[model samples]
Target chain A: MARCRALVRPALVEAVGRLHPWTGEMAAYALGWADPAGTPDPTGSEGKGVRQALALLGAEAVGADGAEAVPGAVAVELVHTFSLLHDDIMDADALRRQRPAVWKEYGTGPAVLAGDALLAQAVAVLAEAPGRHTGAAVRRLCGTLNDLVSGQAEDLRFEDRPWHGPGAVSPDQYRSMAEHKTGALLGCALALGAVLGGAPDRTVTALDRAGRHLGLAFQAVDDVLGIWGDPAVTGKPVHADLRRGKKTYPVLVALAGGGEVAHELVTLLSSGRPVDGEAAELVAALVEEAGGRAATRDEARRHLDAARRVLRETPLEPTAARRLDALFAHLLDRTW
Target chain B: MARCRALVRPALVEAVGRLHPWTGEMAAYALGWADPAGTPDPTGSEGKGVRQALALLGAEAVGADGAEAVPGAVAVELVHTFSLLHDDIMDADALRRQRPAVWKEYGTGPAVLAGDALLAQAVAVLAEAPGRHTGAAVRRLCGTLNDLVSGQAEDLRFEDRPWHGPGAVSPDQYRSMAEHKTGALLGCALALGAVLGGAPDRTVTALDRAGRHLGLAFQAVDDVLGIWGDPAVTGKPVHADLRRGKKTYPVLVALAGGGEVAHELVTLLSSGRPVDGEAAELVAALVEEAGGRAATRDEARRHLDAARRVLRETPLEPTAARRLDALFAHLLDRTW
Candidate 1:
């Protein structure tokens, strides 16, 4: 993973730097490196760059050197950035990573354009990448975007529904939604890596399956943290998800328990106010008592285990697979 | 012109119909045939469908039958529809063609998704079209999208910049912006038509040149009517351009003219009220007194004449060329 980062980082830096001045500025802000007006400032708001790392590691898992996969990694990163820009607007999120989200800083109109520029430029970049794999990769990326929108539509619809009440969600439905929402792109990233590495179909499928589970586990952990993690560590207040009545895995599980504590939690979510100190603790206690905390942790473990099983089935070198396993564990365990 | 409409209308209808059910619903609203919720209702708010007609006519002018050019026309119309959807959002318009705009009816997020679906589906439709020229046409359409976005960005920037104020806009800047905002896609419509018609390069160039000039003329005439046309005829209150503080050709000419009326007109524009009735009439009178209206009319005529010359130069069947020429005149002379 470290080796892949060394190779991928330079290309990303150069590609991002050499963009047309205006586009470069936009991309810089997208990457959490610049202010809205293109000033040079990094406020420690950049993501952990997990997606890029996954792209590189996936390539290595298929026996490709990181040098051959940097462009693909950059392409995936740009697409991810584009999604964040639009998602912020759609969700009406004021902050991302620790700074003003794109729409908040630039207004909805410019943010939309900036996101579009990234999307268009991502396609162009993929077209210019040195591989016949480019065509298939581009198509896959487009499909991922469609899935992203589909997932978002469903997510938004839930906000207006009574789905946040007790007994409202199921494991199957949660998994299905999360797979399309987050896992689809992660699968594409691995598939692209395999394609660039010249891996066979079976090898690609194995890597993709591994990525799907990893992404599921990653999302579950994030959702858990979003509701119960400490404010300082998560960089968002505790019970933030409850405030939005987000139907994350833990909330869904608690709702499915159908008990007095579950009823209280549902009421709290519907209250439409910020969940504070004692209330936050009570909500967390209710979530645990409803078996949600344990269930969410268990579900995360199941996905991670499934990913590891697929990793064993792939054609990756032992060292590469080991590094990937370590990366997946860190991803599942990380704070913030 | 009737023959052109006969060829293009059905094609546009079928093509738009192929948009995802939701997107098609939005298209119906854009065309003024349906409400935002996908309900069918009789309405007259549709665009004139000028771009679609031009594509089919341009194809026929170069010897192709309408049947052979349906896909080309459909592709251009989809691009145009997608642009309108996004433009309405960017312009923050409440009504389009007389009906509620897409964003106003569907919300910004859904409207954006609908626009994106149309664009993605447009690519798919173009790709699946049965023709040797399909790939090239689709690529050109993508380029046209890039141009549209660039033009939109400039337009947004223009709103806040004093240099883009009345009298500050040059003819060259006007043409350049219009070429991107309107002319490029219109030219592509003709170019695609020529491709489908199997026309030679000279014929294609002629059609493209003519389309470009016609687009400019249409926009200039639109600017004139924006401030001075009858509200009943235009379907919008008079002096909409002034209220929006748009730097249209007439306003620029009047602003450049050194006189009291020009100064008064500039003040009226900068005031940014919804000027109408008597105040609007007074502003229209001042616009004419400053020679703004005549100057704009002359400029529009120059573009119309240039379009006529392009038609004369093209090696079209005389009947077809005459038909297209008449269509151009009718469009330019339109009062509504």
Candidate 2:
């Protein structure tokens, strides 16, 4: 992951700099490459570069040097950052990565424009990418964007529905949303890398499937952390999902079971008041008592196992397989 | 322009429908093709399709059937509508084409998502276009987007400065902004059409120059209409720009003249009170008396002449030249 990030960061910065001056500066700040005033920030924190890592790994799996996938890596990362910027505004999130969110640091209008510029830049990067497969790569990226937009629209609509009524979210619906929101781009990253590496269509499809499963596992673990991880480490408040009454996988799973604790949890959450600290603690305890935590953990493990099996069945070199396995372990085991 | 709109409307509708369900519906509504409930509205108003006309005209100028540029036409129109959607939100305008704007009818969140989807789909349509020049066409579209973003950023930034202070907008600055915000896409339309029609680089460049000047003339006329046109014809209140304290080209020109009437006008506008019926009429009289109105009209005429000269110098077929001339006259002569 670190190697892939090192290779793609400079190109990503160059691509972003191609935007109009004000937009470019705001986009750079959102990507952690610069301060709010457009000065370079050498010590700024960066994202995990998960999509870039997946792109490189997919390329390597097809017996190509990962350098061929640098454009795809940069394109996916820009799209990811674009989503984050707009999502922060839509969600009205105040903080990100332990700092003020883009919409908070800049005004909402500028932040929206910055995100708009980044989105355009993402497509532009792929369109100008130097490769024989550039056309197919852009189509795949567009498909991913469609899924991302659909997923986000669904998520926002979900927020307006009753938690336990006819329109209430179900676990399957949650998984589907997760696939569209998180899994689609991850899948596209691998597919783009494979296509750029001149892999067979079958191998590319296999890599895409593996990526989707990996994305599911990633989001499952994130959901767990959102509920129980140390706030100091995660940069989010403990039981954050519960406090916000977010209908995450665990909460949906517990709600489906309809046990006494599940009913109590639902009653407390659906009251339409801000969940105080004590209510959050009690809700978390009730969710755990209803087997939600263990169920979610099991789901993550299942996805990780499935992803590993898919990769093993693919015709990847032994070294590539080993590297992918190591990275998977690292991602799932990370404390932060 | 009506002919071009008729030719591109189906393709544009199909392209917008390629987005996710919710986003596609909102985009359709924004484009004035459907109602908020996703029902088709036969009487819905549409844009002038100026960019589409330029693309088709450019194609014809190069001796290709105008149909060859339909994809480019559709792409540019989608981008134009995308900009309109976002700009409406940023400007907080409640109406467009005398109807409730997309953001006003559907809310800002969905409108933003719809715009993002349209932008991606614009590039996607070109990438999947069935022609040898698809790659180059996509690149040109991206470059145009860069200019559009920059133009919008400058326009927004200009709003932050005082109207009569040192940072007040200048006529040259307004022209530069219009060039980016309006001219770039128009230039791109012609370039994309020329490229698709297999025109040489020199001819493409000339067409682009012609398109840019045409765009400038269009905007100049628009600025003039914003202040002096009848509300019944323009679909906006009389002197709408002055009422909003917008530093339009004529206003900037009047400010730069620094006459006694201009000084009084500035003081009245800068007082921060809303310009009512009497004030709007007074400001209009002052601007006209200061020669701002005449100057702006002259500027538009000059640009129209320049655009015509550039088109004439290009080695266009005789019939194509006649058609271009007719369209140019129609655009400048429109009352609304």
Candidate 3:
């Protein structure tokens, strides 16, 4: 993985730099390469680069040179970056990766431009990519982007109309949001890999399904951690979702019966009252009692298992498939 | 123009439909095809579709079948629509073409999606267009889109900082913005015409230069109208630019004098106070006194002259060239 990252860095940098030369500096900040002012600086922040990695991983999964997927990888990363920019603004997030979010650091206009730049670059990269499936690649990238935005629209609506309300959000609705918001892109990541590898339709479908399941499970686990996990590990305050009045999977399951505690929690959240330490502790206690925590874990496990099944069904080589299997296991057991 | 509009309607419907099958109904609302809820009703909405008309007109300018430019026309119109979506959001505009803006009706999330969908379709149209300059066309379109966005960024930034404020924007700066925001796409319209006409580089350059001038003039005229034009005709209140605190060409030119009225207008706009009735009249008076109104008109006229010169230089056939000249004359001379 380290070698792969190293190999793709120059290509990624070159492609992004050339395509978005004007906003490349701002984009560099997004990719953790520079500061907000478009100046050169060391210690640029970086992500786990999971999407890019997945692109290459997907390529390898179907017996292609991982390097060949570099453009596709970059395209996926740009899409993800654009979403993070808008998402930060929509959520009014102050921090990202222990630093001020894009909107916080540079204000809304630049933040929005930064996202637009990334989106445009993503298309440019796909358009100029050196490979077969040029038309298909662009179309797929666009279709995935369209779905991601649609998912965001649904998510925004869900914010004002929480599924759980005084109760909890259903697993189904949560899954639906996760699929649209997160899973669609992940599925695209896998599909791009298959497309690059010149894999058959059946194989692409299997990989895409695997990605979808994995994405849902990943989101479900994130919801669990958002409410009950340690802040230090998750980089967020404990019961943050609850405090923010979010209807995550665990909370929904816990409030399915709409018990007294659930009702109290809902009232506290809806009233916009301060979520103090005592309230946080009580919410945690209620979550535990409502079986929300256990239910989330169980659902996450089921999806992960389902993802692995799809992975096994795909026509991946033994070595590549083994690596992916290990990767999934690590992700499934992620504490953060 | 009426015939062009009619021919383009089905294509617009079909293009947007393919671009967003499910959400296409919502897109129709954006294009003035349907009401906010997808109800079938055309209440004298849908702009003159000036870009599409220009595209078809340009096709005729080069003696190509007007219908041949439908996809190209649609492509430009899509870009135009995307700009409207983003601009409405940025400006917090509540209405468009006498109806609720997409962002106002559907909210920011869907507004953003609608823009994305349009951009994607624009590229798709170019990709599928069976033209010799398809590759160059796509690149030019992308380049034009980038320029517009960067220009918009500059425009947004100049909000708090006037043309001659802390981040004082110069005429050169304004020119760059105008070139991108309006000129580049207009250039694309003419370039698409030449591509269809199989015109030489010299002819293309003349058309492109003419377009650039036309765009700059149009923007300048727009700025002039924003402050001093009749409200009923422009569909904007008197001194709309002054009230909104926009650093338009005239405003910028006047600010260069460092006059008290310019200072006062800047202060009033930045204070977030409403500007209407007496305040609006006062701003209009101040702008005229500062010579902004006259300077803007003079600048616009200069561009119009330059554009006419280029049109004369171009090797367009007599009849087609005459139509082109008339079309541009009307565009430059329009009151609203």
Candidate 4:
């Protein structure tokens, strides 16, 4: 993980530098290279390098130097950054990493351009990479972007949906959205890394599946944190997703029971307003009491186990595969 | 032109069909595939088939069937559509093609996603093409997208600059923006089409230059139309560009002169309100008196001549080259 981070930051910087100066500044802020005031932050505030680590480990699993996967790693990270920038604009999210979001700091139009530039950069870096596999990798990444956009469309559409009845959000629907929104990019990262590493087709497919399962597990963990994790650790308002009326796994699972507690939980969440203060705590408690929290944990465990099973079955380089397993464990640390 | 349009429409519809359904609907509306209420529009409202015609003719210029260049043609056309959808959002323009812009009809977030999906599909179609040159084509298209974003960034920033100062938008800067925003994709269309048709690098580069020159000429013509063309012919309100305070060739050149007309022109334009009715007519007259109209026409002719010179110099197929010249004449028909 540390090694991939070291390889990633410099290469990522070079890739992003290819953008226009104005858009580059906004992108720098989005990727944690600068503060909201546009001053450089030497101590960068980037997310844990899960996508990059998975990419490098994917290359290593095919017995290639992880350095060979640098372009794919940079590409996936940029796509992730692109999604964050645009998602904030769509969601009207005011803060990112406790700083002003890109749209907030730079205005909506500039934020849109910044995101577009990053996505362009992502495709450019990979397409220009020297490899017979680069074309396939580019197609894979582009296809993932299609799925990611669809997932986001659904996520936004969910807000307009009722909290219960035939039109209500379901666990199955939430899982599919998670798979598309978060899992598709993560899956592409590992698969693209393997392709760049010159892995066999079967190995690439296996790694992609493994990464997707890991992505779903990671998303469930994130949903849990959004509601119950410590704000000091999560870097967000406590019960932030609940306050936003986000259709997360725990709350939906809790509501699916159709009992009195489920009915009461629905009433609170269906009010079409930001659930806050004492009401937020009660909402959380009701979700837990209705078994939403436990159901979510079980879903996480199920996906994580599936990922582990796939890894065990695949004939990857032992050391690299083990490292990947350790990395996933570190990401969703509660399971371990 | 008719043949290329025939080839382009169905191919474009097929390509756009690959997008997520919701986004696909908005893109369909943007591309003249459907009406605002999402009904199919058999009488399509698409733009002139300039880019598509250029791409197909490029292949034929390289001694291949025009049909061979379908993917590249489709890709460039989608990129153009993507830009229009996003540009309308940034400009806050309510109308496009006598109807609501994508953002107005579908809302901003979905509009953003719809544009993104088209871009992804653009790169995907090119990368997935069956040829040895597919990689180079993908890289070329992606690089063009980066430039397109930069061009858009500059255009938006120009709005914040003073009308006359060191920080003012220069003719040179406007030319650069026009190249990036408008020319890049057009250049890629011709260049990628030639590449896919198996042309040598030099030939590909020549077509790219021709397309860019043609783009500059086309933009100048469009700028003139924005201010002075018949609204019935242009399908837009009279003085639309002046009303919106857009930086265009004639207006910028008119403002460049240090004279009475320039001073009054600056005063009227710098007030930062939409110029309309009698005031708009006066601005038009002042621009004409300051030699802006003639200067713009001269600039367009200069670039068009350069494009012709390049085409004459290149060793392309005679039949295709003649056909391409005719297409150019038909497009910039006024001067011809």
Residue B216 alpha-carbon offset, candidate 3, angstroms: 1.5
C-alpha TM-score for every candidate:
0.85, 0.94, 0.84, 0.96
Q: Per-prediction TM-score of chain B? A: 0.89, 0.96, 0.92, 0.96
Candidate achieving the largest TM-score: 4
Chain A TM-score of each model, in the order shown?
Answer: 0.91, 0.97, 0.92, 0.96
lDDT of 1 at A86: 76
Each prediction's total of clashing residue pairs, residues at least 3 apart in sequence or on different chains, is: 1, 0, 2, 0
Candidate RMSDs in Å, in order, are 4.1, 2.3, 4.5, 1.9
TM-score of chain B of 4: 0.96
- Candidate 3: give the clashing pairs: A164-A168, A168-A252
lDDT of 3: 0.75
* Candidate 4: share of reference interface contacts reproduced: 0.76
DockQ, all candidates in order: 0.29, 0.69, 0.30, 0.81
lDDT of each: 0.74, 0.85, 0.75, 0.88
Candidate 2 — which residues are off by over 4 angstroms?
Answer: A259-261, B164-166, B258-273
Give the TM-score comparing model 2 with the true structure, all chains together. Answer: 0.94
- Docking level for model 4: high
Model 2 lDDT at residue A56: 82
Query: Could you tell me how far off, in angstroms, the CA of residue B267 lies in candidate 2 after the best superposition?
Result: 4.0
Worst 10 residues of 1 chain A by lDDT: A160-169
> What shift in Å separates residue A110 of candidate 2 from its native position after superposition?
1.0
- Cα DockQ of the candidate 3 complex: 0.30
